[model samples]
Target chain A: MDKIENNKAWFLVLPVFVIVAISAIIPLMTVVNYAFQDIFSPQDRYWVGTEWFESVLADDDLHGALIRQFVFSFVILLIEIPLGIALALAMPARGWRASLALVLMALPLLIPWNVVGTIWQVFARADIGLGGWLVNALGIPYNYTSDPVAAWLTIVVMDVWHWTPLVVLLCYAGLRAIPDAYYQAAAIDGATPWKVFRHIELPKMRGVLLIAVLLRFMDSFMIYTEPFVVTGGGPGNATTFLSIHLTKIAIGQMDLGPAAAISIIYFLIILTLSFVFYNVMTRMGTGERA
Target chain B: MSLQLQGIARTVGGSIHLHPVDALLEPGLHVLLGPTGAGKTSLMRLMAGLDAPSAGRILQDGQDVTGVPVRQRSVAFVYQQFINYPSLSVFENIASPLRLKGQERGAIERRVREVASLLHIDHLLDRLPAELSGGQQQRTAIARALAKDARLLLLDEPLVNLDYKLREELRTELRALFERRGAVVIYSTTEPIEALTMGGSVLVMHEGRVLQAGPTAQVYHHPASEAVAEVFSDPPMNLVNVEVTGGTARFPQGLELPLTGHLGMLEDGAYRFGIRALHLALRPKPGLPFLPARVELADISGSETFVHVHAEGLDWVVQEEGVHEHGLGEPVTVYLDPTRLYAFGPDGRVRAAPARGRGG
Candidate 1:
């Protein structure tokens, strides 16, 4: 077969490049510009170089927020991934029940993030909320507004309730994609149910689990609106994640240059972590299949 | 161990997949020969306890195990598609069954190596299933099944997915392997040559029913019904409708063939005369009846040749050894021994007769 050398294909890709530049690249460049310059007015901008970056990096508050952010993401992932896989395994394999379960699992994901925060905020109040009232009725001292532990627990539980469904849905799809022949062969081999899941289902779900991990990691690392609406980073900054801190720097105190620098650093952190995750996961998945 | 299926029937969604079937399978290689949608896989699955039968019971060594799940039964099945634990190496895949039974690691390794060597895949034990070819993957699956040491082994068209040359090689290897395993192995296939080469008891099935079951040679030489004969022959048994009158059967072309023995016992009426392609000689010999046919198509496959002839408004396939060229539309005379022919009564049942000498 003769190859068709067509330079005209370059013209087809030009529109996509232009759209990306207008939608993403241009805005990112503006942030990059803001990170390096101090602007007192529209025309009174002065170059600051790495001064704001150094300050943001040295700030103890920023360090604390970054640690808190890491802890939250790590804790949630440890809980959510296993819980989701177990839920997916327990779900119905077929029929109307499967359809209904899928819809119910997807309900939390469909709700707006801020709406989830608002709902939890009202639902966790000690005087009127069911959860808070029940806890108090059970003779436990639980007040999220005053106790740091209670606030952290409430935020983690709220995040789990709102996001664990995503992991469950992805794992469920992975489970369903496995062919029935594998299970049949395993059964005939006298494999126990745990052995079946460990050898067959877990290996087959590796690719989807990787995706779920990456998605949940990046999303949880950048979480803002829910915590911001619920606790507003209160209880002596116990739940003040990096995103909330960045927002407070950029809008609450109007420190644009340091906020821009922190934003760039946060983006780099996520990018580096995601790249590491993707490389490790793809290697593992391909290595097993290979 | 002896495995018996007692009046087993399988129905899915209110439609019958396999009607009630009862058969006693002894310890040896038994071939289940059938065409597609013949319920061969379903029957195998039921026997392996992978699926419960809608009716009847399964007995193993005179013990009822119909209610037992597949994992509790000492049975192993190899599917048409080569199924392996994709994440595991060939060694691990074979060792998995023993591991599931909580066997020690040393014993598991020994059994895995033994089965791998038997299947000639010991060198590929470290490789994953995806890295292996179709034939290698199936061999690995077979090795895994063998390592399990199940008393009853079920293989549903295990070689159907392999290439022609690989299929032939594996068929020979599998026949020997089954003999050494000392298990009651039930192998299903749609190919007649495979059933013949395996050389054991044969169960001929069609449309969810068992038409015939007996020794492989007995079924081949004497199919119980026209349906069984059709499924038992490669180009399908050449069945010609004949009218019998005065102890003689006459073809449509007015050729009167002498009816002897059991064929002569039938009252004068319409009957079906069946003959295998190999029994029809292209050349006429002494004491053999000849039929006039016109060559319609000649299909030469490797060393064997199949000549399709239109004889008296009926198409007949004649199998010939080696290559023999015959021009299309050429008039030819094919020889067939009357004693070797099978006669089917009006009800489609084979008319049983005393065994005759095997002829070329």
Candidate 2:
């Protein structure tokens, strides 16, 4: 009985564990190793204690970039969560109409992330883009290229357009997973539409919403491609988020030690925030920490 | 009309409309009895004011509630599913309606606890629906509807999801519960046993239309047609088409007998006739008349026995109370109680000449 119990089928997860450990753990260890060392060349390295971390902690550029990252994540969240729920509510519940609505909503999510950036890059241009022409025709000087506020607005709107579908799809699936009888019961209870949404739909969608928030927050925090492609950290660093600043220091200025410090700080920020997020999100479902 | 559904038929995606139901659903237990997909749910929703009936007006207490929204109608709908609120505890779910009506908190608490206790779910007061078993959840739903105090309760196969024994138990309890409340309950189910046992005047529906409606005994005794008779019993009512000629009804394959009473009223061509299993008996006596039959299958279930027999080439089930001593292939005599026999005309409607006895 003990032999039978211990006879685990190695085929079940042999390849998966190998891939994850090799790709994830080894790379993580390498990053950690690089975080606290002085590298003069690819072959030459020396231990520098917490010297890199100290410089990173003192860097004013890292601080500014950190603020920009949080602001973008918070703003994206504020715009997307409610908009996603609203879109989900508006979707048809049954028949071909529901399927068609779902397909349309999922279209944006299916597009490549970089393609989404490139499409919006052309789409948000002042001269040829529809939005630009509309604003210019309306007699407003709407040049996102030259204006920091316009650039930030463009980046936020582009991100919303590209990623709102993820939130909408998650919330829609959550809402659809609810049985029709629940709605019937609510109606029998004499709940108005608003009350039904608040008490039933809101509570039911909490788990999915929590997931959406965490996923979107992490993605927006590590946002690199879309804004990098669209704004190019332009309009005088107004749209230069954490990733852009890190890349500029590491690759542009070629400062290996301080840049390594900055990267370590960025990694720590992400790890800490993500841990907090997982705790908060996990608590939402059961109203208790596991 | 109390609850008017005039020319009510629904056609979806060019398929045939189930049928047009034009009848008044009166107050008290209106047990909608039919086979599955007889548009029972569609009819219940239309009656509950949850849905709009095509080409019809739903008049509730003589009001044109066809135009009124479900919320305005004050109708309570209890689905077959256990649909209690997952986020709310049992107490909260039961008290939600009272709070919505702006009832005082003390009164709401009193009523909620009373109903919860009445339903035997008091111990589960603080538990969410997600934590409860199916039966408990179903009881919670019933408790919630009871809290609404709706004049009409549209229970759409509400007890169907429970297991067999639990279903019967709940059915009796629900019947008593509804009776105590004096509520107009239009409880829909395709199961005839539910209609029969639940103390409701039966409304037999087939394909969305009301086939017949009366006290269970009356309807069972004089089922408007073969279809109506078929709708009343478990293992169902057995039919044997016969020829009635010159005050004589004869089973072409089995035996010929004198139809002394209503045989002269018989029409031409085939007469689709029915005799419920219980209505026909098989016992020997000195003077009593009997029909010769060959026992084809004597299915002796513990509660009841269904003796499938061939008499004069006509086949039917003879419902027996005690166990049948006869073997499956044995020859036996069936005593046909002509008074309990039902006859349908060539067109399958109940012969206006009348039937003698009830199935109850």
Candidate 3:
């Protein structure tokens, strides 16, 4: 068979390249440029190669913030994934109740991140809000502004409240894609509910779960707004995550070179971790099928 | 074992899926023959205990099991779709039912291997369902169902999704397998030839009711009504309006046949005549009427040919034994033997059936 020869389609993609260069590539390249040079102004700069990188990599504050970021992301994933799955499983399968439940689950996700932070901020106040006042009434002496432990708990709970719905929605979509025949077959096999979840539901949800895990991991790693509004980097630097610390160095103290270096490093860290997470999940999914 | 359905019916969301079905199935193959959306699956699901009937009771060997769930019954079901555990290897998929029953490891292994070999899927044991072809995946599902050793097996058009050759091969193997098993096998299919080839008692269903149920050959030879005859045919039996008066039956195409054999028993009134596709012949006999027909379509399917023609304002299909070429709009003559004609009354009831012809 003689195939049609056409080369006109290649020129159609030029506009997309131009738009991406203007929107993303150019900004990213400027950051890369700043990371290599100590820029006081566009006209006054020194080619201080790797100096900012070395200093940013060795800073004690950077190291502390990095560890804190990792722990927060880890805890978020640990709490959110299973909780989302359980909630999705508990949701009604059909009718008006299912539609209402879906709407309720999506309510928290629709709120703006900063707005969510402010709502939690006021909602956790011991004097006026229900959450903290109820906790104080139980004699726990809860106050997010004064105690580092209370601040951490408040931030974690707020993030869970705002984001677990994404995971639930993803898993629920995956659950609904499965045909009813599998469940009937499992029932005929006399499989218990746990076994059905393990063998049928979990395996069928693997693709969506991978997306959920990676999205949650990357989003939580880069999380800044809600925690910043709620804790302002904590009672005494306890919640100063990498993004907040970078913002402090870049804007508050105005160290452009070091902050640029930290930004590049932060981008690289998220990219590398997301890559590793994706590969491991896909490999695990195929390993069973293989 | 015996499974009895007492007026079992199913209604979903104000629509009836099955209506008051009563059946007694013994430990043998029973083929449910019907077209799509004819309630074959709904009836089978009720029998499998997968769905609760809106009315009536089901008894297993005289024990009521109407309220029982599928897990409590000794029954296995295979859907038309090749549904296997996509994440499990063929061996584990087959072993699932056995393992669920808490059989010993040795017993599970032995039974899985035995059923896998029976289905000719033993070599694909280590491969997952995703890794196998559709036919092999369906065979693995069948193996899993067989490993359960259930007293009742329900296969709902299991081969309907396969290619033609694979369908033929699996049908042969499944019939052989069902022959030796003591389970009451209820297989549902829309193909009448498949039911006949399986050679079992058949339940002919139309709309939401079983129009007729009897031995396969008996139902094929003498369908209870025109509805049953249509459901039990492939290209559909050719029907033509007829008038019987003055002791002679007259066709609309100006062909006449003297009342003889089964036609003699019919009263003088309007009737419908039915002729199977294969009984319409291109070569004419001395006693049969030679009606002129115009070829509408000639479908040459491998060794057989189905010639669709228009005669007397009605279209009819003529099944030729070999590949015969006929061009569209070409005039041809078709002969219908009076002895092979079936007479139906005004209400579609089979009034008179022809005597059993050669290989009918």
Candidate 2: RMSD over Cα atoms?
Answer: 4.7
Q: Write the per-residue lDDT of candidate 1 for residues A1-290, one digit (tens) a residue.
A: 99999999999999999999999999888889899999888799999999999999999999999999999999999999999999999999999999999999999999999999999898898989999889988999898889989999999999999999999999999999998999999878777788788888988899889999999999999999999998999888999999999999999999999999999999999999999988888777335541
Write one digit per residue (lDDT tens) for candidate 2, span B1-360: 256667677766676445777776666778888888777888877777666766677777777777677777677888888876667788998998888889999999999999898889999999878778889989998898888888778888988898887898888888888877656788888777778888668888876567888887678667887788788777677677778777677766556666655555665567877767876777764444467788888888877888889866578788888886777678887776666667888777877323544336
Model 3 pairs in collision: none
CA lDDT, candidate 3, residue B238: 92
Ordering by lDDT: 3, 1, 2
| Candidate 3 lDDT, A1-290, residue by residue in tens | 99888898778998999999999999999999999998878899899999999998999999999999999999999999999999999999999999999999999999999999999998999999889899999999999988989999999999999999999999999899889999999999999999899888998888899999999999999999998998899888999999999999999999999999999999999999999988888777444431
| TM-score of model 1 (CA atoms) | 0.87
2 or 3, greater by lDDT: 3
Candidate 1 or 3, higher DockQ?
3
> Could you report the DockQ of all the candidates, in the order they appear?
0.43, 0.29, 0.49
Give Cα distance to truth, residue A84, candidate 1, Å: 0.5
| Cα RMSD, each candidate | 3.8, 4.7, 2.2
Best by DockQ: 3
